[model samples]
Target: MHLSIGEAPNGAEGGATTATRPRDAQGTNEPAEPGSPSQTIVTFADFGLDPSILKAVAELGYREPTPIQAQAIPVVMAGKDVMGAAQTGTGKTAGFALPIIHKLLPLASTSTSPARHPVRALIIAPTRELADQIHENVKAYSRHTPLRSAVVFGGVDMKPQTAALRGGVEILTATPGRLLDHVEQKSTNLSQVQILVLDEADRMLDMGFLPDIQRIINLLAAQRQSLMFSATFSPEIRKLARSFLKEPQLIEVARRNALADNVEQTVYRVDGDEAKRAAVASLIRDRALEQVIVFSNTKIGAGRLARQLQKEGLKAEAIHGDKSQQERLQTLEAFKQGEIKVLVATDVAARGLDIVELPAVINYDLPHSPEDYVHRIGRTGRAGASGMALSLMVDKDQRALADIEKLTQRKLTVEALAVTLPGRRGDSREFSADAYRGSGREKRGREGTAARRDSSPDRDRSPPARRSGSSPNRSPAKTDPFFSRPYEPAEDAGVEAAAEPAARNGLRRPARKVAALLGGKP
Candidate 1:
């Protein structure tokens, strides 16, 4: 059974997050007063970490431990295997990184000799963004100590990563594929890795990284402490645990697929594709979401949504697998800097984003995997701040909605949303996404389709206008009905008349009898 601990309060990342603002216990980053709701029972020092590590934590202004941190630090310090299942944005990174850093301090060295530092702890994440994020957290916690950390992922040249690996790092963070690539090149050594962390293991399975994970594990020390973290403990996740972890401690700060109650979720049922885009635009326009991430199910959908929002005069950008790694980083930086108001992204490509205190999230297309629903909304209402989650649902999304409800164990009410678009005549048409409301798109589509079918087989639906640089009287080619008429036998008038008969049909040249051609000059 999943652990039944109550929902984790926001803004407190004992070990959960690397980026901590003055967040109150409820997880919001707002400053705290004497009587503020935030409460702390233990400080980072209580964990008996190295003085330098505590000093670094103090520099970041973290006092209390998040639930995961409170439960995980001691377990990790004890060198016990752990199976941690928590909701997204619950500070899972800090939960594992800190304790691992403390554990590695006894083996840490100040000497710059390449032999002094070895890959002691290895963290495997599902995506490049996530791998980089975990690496950053490790670096932050180990800053005051002699522990060195580095990250390697795909979508970039390997030379730099190869150099870092060769330079020797105590802690290594990498995505499964890139880690394997480095292993193949013999640039990274995993034989001495004592602590193995599979952060977001479920995502790895979802990404089909099981074989890669197994291969990497085979290269690691057999007796090492294994830690597996995921949002849920699906059957597949459980099987993975059985294969790797040896009687690991189970830690769940939130229930399976649990959502942050701090986030307000609203589902809007819309009409057609155009209406969906308009609904997203209207939501952003009407709600004035200064910084929001809109999630799409496909890379093309993400690009299209971002472009459509841009045409609507909204500052938007798209980030997905198709984009080059540099472009993705630039777009993400712009979004984080508030230069881009909307960041449309597909599921896996966006797996690495960690925005602090983001106010809202919008689902342009409901994800086919229900688990992703929880992950997408978890981006907002983070650090205990109240946030909004809005989803635009269409007729075909009913089953997906049902699956989500079944997964999250909550009944989501579908509401009508009015989306307005500029009409063809400089007017505005406001309509609801509810089908029973009879959106104008249905009527217009039926009429337009019938009109096209009834008129010439190939005719323009656009207004009838002359091309600017074409013939003024230019028209479609046509045929004469007379040419298609059936042949009729006329009475033979006279031999001369027949001999010099006027050109018939489309023939203009005269015809001679077969025998006349026998003459040499005929």
Candidate 2:
């Protein structure tokens, strides 16, 4: 479900309505508010929005307000507290930002005094990317107004953030940690804040930022209008909402935890760990996947596979926590600009990184949690565009796959792949699985060439022949003698532990993949 706030049409009294607007195929309103339960709506001018803000919205190519926008805009225009619930990828950022900008425009115009430089509106996000995203949206919505805005997050340096604050911004979008740091340094103030928005409230709770959030909330004035927006409203979110919002208006576009109907999802049942990578690569080549995002369980796996793809002459790059903010930003920019082709990323780099039209998102490794699976796939299929999500499953990943299917309440189409990506350390000759499973005579006919080797001519080669009396104590490593190395379980350890080398290399390493799910061919 998606939620938003906006103004009622001109001369229409301010009041809240729970009715929904009828949304079209693009999740847009047909001359009505998109995703709205009803066709009824209003214009920005009708809501008494500032000329500057209205002009900015129009310039952004937004014709009519979305459902959330149509319903919520009026209440917000009347200065009421709002609680919005919508799926991710909806225009929630502008839902609150537009009205807030309108309300603050007059205040900003008359209050040029240095004493009033303290922030008047605060937007808190769970991730740096989200914070940056909201900041960008605020800038666009408020472009025609004189309001100044800035973004602050933990991964980057503090000096510049401090400087930005000192320059006087009316609206501040930030991640909690850095925001607290600023408060501790006394470099910024929020005492006079009239509006506060907590975007992605569910994510903040999941991040264990409840304490920090509470602290920030306590510092704000009690008389302020509070708006909390999230993809889902859990019990915890409801409790927290009570403390911050006074008689808040609730808006939900979809039922909780539902995915968009537009996405086409599938799974591949790979038999062995060695085959997974090859299968993904084969899929990429066969499907001619372009601008695709391959998600891995660990940072190392993502990096190693990205580098291997590059070595194979495919453009690839990996992004994770280890990369410096500047490098991550640069790599993301390069990917966006089409300088690279395939992008391998961990879940941390996944959410809130919006690409205009991502086409495919591959689950190189399944997500740890079902909710995360939703978030990962959500990166694609945005804004009514069609998208595809493919999950590569080895034997052990069954449980994770099951959880995802159960949570989504849908069956995923599973198929076998012809090949997979090579393992991280070295490339292996592609082997065919079909030969061994064929009819007996056909298998025997191809055995000599496919098997290629035997323990002298006297040794039997059939499956039954090997099972009859073969020694069990022999090391499994001897089968591939040329580059034999004892198998270490740690090589495929947990996601964070595996990405150490990639973290060390950061963005300096050449050959990274740059794929987004919905854009262009891939």
Candidate 3:
């Protein structure tokens, strides 16, 4: 049985709405805090979007604008650049996409000619998954319109992407790297682009895409509408905005690194790295968590955690950068379809993944960046749905927890977790540092060495002990008698033997030659 160290509050129900207020210097409006009732009610119909676009919105069952969407849509539709900061899973795509589609509808072409498309709108995302997600949303939003949309990113064959680009698309979603690849190949032109969006702009900077971003900017038309959206606006992001965006309105629905109120945060204090795996297994097993996404700090750690969970009789799989595009997509699909119980992933899946009604998320390792903590848990508790965020924290995690608290502007509840893993013998206190590292062969080698004898100088210089395959005493193999006999010399006068050979050959020898050659007195 598993017991929660800290009893978390079941977050209050009821949705919050955003309304327009006086703009500040950055063109930002403060919405009411979560759970604080607002007198004004806002809806998508108020945005004056085309009837066809409204049809798609109605079909998708979206009623009102999220806080970010409410603040961003009006400013974007007014033909002004915007810099927005909102937590992940906050309908950030719809905030920008709806307006972009609305603005581009007038230019939408019924003709199938390539010149009519001219790449009118471009949305650049940091990861392939995010790009695909944005493309899907844009496609859904613009279904009734004559606008054509497509996505391109690295991984898989570029031939298909090239063909799509050459054919023409009005709305394009692409990653920085692959977009630059298309630029180099001259497969797509960005000159006629009227609107540009940098989704997850901070993540792009973190991934060192500044140079690629600059190159793409150079290719775009000078006069264009641009929007930048991310969870946090770092100094670099601000600098990027200053360089490109002109009099851009700022839209921040939440504070920097602010977590969703709907996710009940809890941390399980594990004894050490060895206990972390057991703790995760115990929590999932005890809670009977049928679906959960466990976050790992590294790709290797994600793979190892997935394996450990599977060994404990859980259906789990890992998705990370090391995986192929198809592999990650398939794994995500399996997890989404309820075929897999657990999905262990790295920060790659932290942003732009829209998993509807995700019940919970577990942190197998605390993130290095405080900002990442927000995105990691943002996968759940989306759209006012209650969810759980559990993290396994060892002694070293205190500093990270502090960073998270400082960024989120709140303290997190951490409680001790006593884990009892099945199919393993002995106390967890006995796990040596090497026991949890690398392959099993290395640990077994150390155990074998300790089993032989205690450390001593004699052991250092002695020959290696025989392995289990060797026998201490055994009969030697038989040998031939003739080969074993001792050497015997024939007693022929050395000079006479040499003289007989020379005489038989009818050859004359120098007087002292034979003696000198034989090492005799000359």
Residue 361 error for model 1, in Å? 0.8
Angstrom error of the Cα, residue 106, model 2: value is 1.6
lDDT per residue for candidate 2 within 333-378, as digits (tens), equals 7777777778889876755666656778899888888877877777
Q: Runs in model 1 with CA error above 4 Å?
A: 1-41, 424-428, 437-473, 477-522
Model 2 residue runs over 4 Å out of place are: 1-39, 42-47, 110-113, 420-522
Instruction: Write one digit per residue (lDDT tens) for candidate 3, span 159-262.
Output: 99999988889999999999999989998999999999999998899889999999999999999999998777788899999999998877766645556687
Write down the TM-score for model 2. 0.74
The CA lDDT of each predicted structure is 0.78, 0.72, 0.76
lDDT of 1 by residue, 171-289 (tens): 99999999999999999889999999998888899889999999999999888999999877899999999999998877766545667778889999875666788889988878888
Cα error of candidate 1 at position 144, Å = 1.4
Residue pairs that clash (backbone atoms under 3 angstroms), model 3: none
Q: Using TM-score, give the best candidate's number.
A: 1
What is candidate 2's CA lDDT for residue 146?
73
Error of 1 at 342 (Å): 0.6
lDDT of 3 at 474: 56
